[model samples]
Target: MNDAIHSSKAPEPVGLYPHARRVGNLLFLSGVGPRQRGSRDIPGVTLNAQGEIVDYDIATQCRSVFDNVRNILEECGSSWERLVDVTVFLTNMKADFKTYNAIYADYFRDNQPARTTVEVLSLPTPIAIELKCIATID
Candidate 1:
């Protein structure tokens, strides 16, 4: 059976899904964006009235996305060291990979988890990046 885990420290899910779910010892995190918890504001993003991205800083968005993921990890009784895999989505891979990779390295450092980064046309929100992770509790 699957169990949902919600973190009060993270932003409310923009969609119907819960923040993360666990099946046995493995926890699967939903795609987490850069939205702030109370304000719902996306850091480093500037959107037009139509909700299209005008300007964005991938570094800022990257940090917030990871922060959200970290919050989920903590709330789920896991830790960064427990992360087994990570999948990252970026709206602009060519333009943003360097900065995002740098910040990511800072976080993971020597305990790097298996990772994949992909470029997408857009996300549900106007943010530049999102992260999904799988971690083990035992």
Candidate 2:
């Protein structure tokens, strides 16, 4: 029942915050972005060299966001199987929701977690997607 922080080898935290925090048996993860470690390059489904939305393509951004989430989960001594809930924030829901759901299904094939998706005017970056979750460490 102690409050502690956890990190994994998937990617380093952008700041002082740990990838997740554990209280009791539950772990709370921060919102995850699509920036891969050591490389400022953001994977794009359609955008060119510049960072742009590129006609609402979501697969690449969705996958990268999930990869970041997976990394954080692994570092926190958890996995997708232990996930209890997730909250997804998107800049454009009308165009990207279906694509995001399709890509998201690839990861949550089992132990489907409770989820909420919301449409937002913008995200931290121009990226189309971001995800945050809660999990249990077994």
Candidate 3:
């Protein structure tokens, strides 16, 4: 594995994992939450009963998550278009999938990277979504 890369513009990692790790030309990004910059805790407004944030009315949270992802990707000399695969984890699979896809479509408008989305029992803080991606740099 190549040295891990981090982004100051993104939220500080809450656990032992680095923000992202690069090996050769491939970057493996840890699952990213919707925590805003400089805040260790996720914004409490949009979450559901299962601790997953409600993504329906909140475009900002979605944007923040993508921004965090972009920051990490850029730190490793890549971008959203370079993403080859993504796995999205959500607390409520049924309600939020469409909204998530609508917002996500704005980001991956062109490349349409391979992706999988799963609804899990729970997450770190009941946040709405967590995303992990594999990307190629150059």
Instruction: Indicate which candidate wins on lDDT.
Output: 1
Looking at model 3, the pairs that clash are: 46-54, 47-53, 51-126, 53-127, 53-128
* Model 3 deviation from the true structure expressed as Cα RMSD, one decimal place: 3.2
Q: lDDT values of the candidates?
A: 0.89, 0.78, 0.79
Kindly report which residue pairs in candidate 1 clash with one another.
Answer: none
| Least well predicted 10-residue stretch by lDDT in candidate 2 | 4-13
Better of 1 and 3 by lDDT: 1
lDDT of 2 by residue, 11-122 (tens): 4555667777788789998778776776666666455566665654578878888888887888777887899999999988888888888888888887799999999898
Query: Please, what is the TM-score per model?
Result: 0.94, 0.83, 0.85
- Better-scoring candidate (lDDT), 1 or 2: 1
State in Å the error of residue 109, model 2. Answer: 1.9
Off by over 4 Å in 3: 40-58
Please give the lDDT score for candidate 1. 0.89
The list of candidate 2 runs beyond 4 A from truth reads: 1-16, 45-56
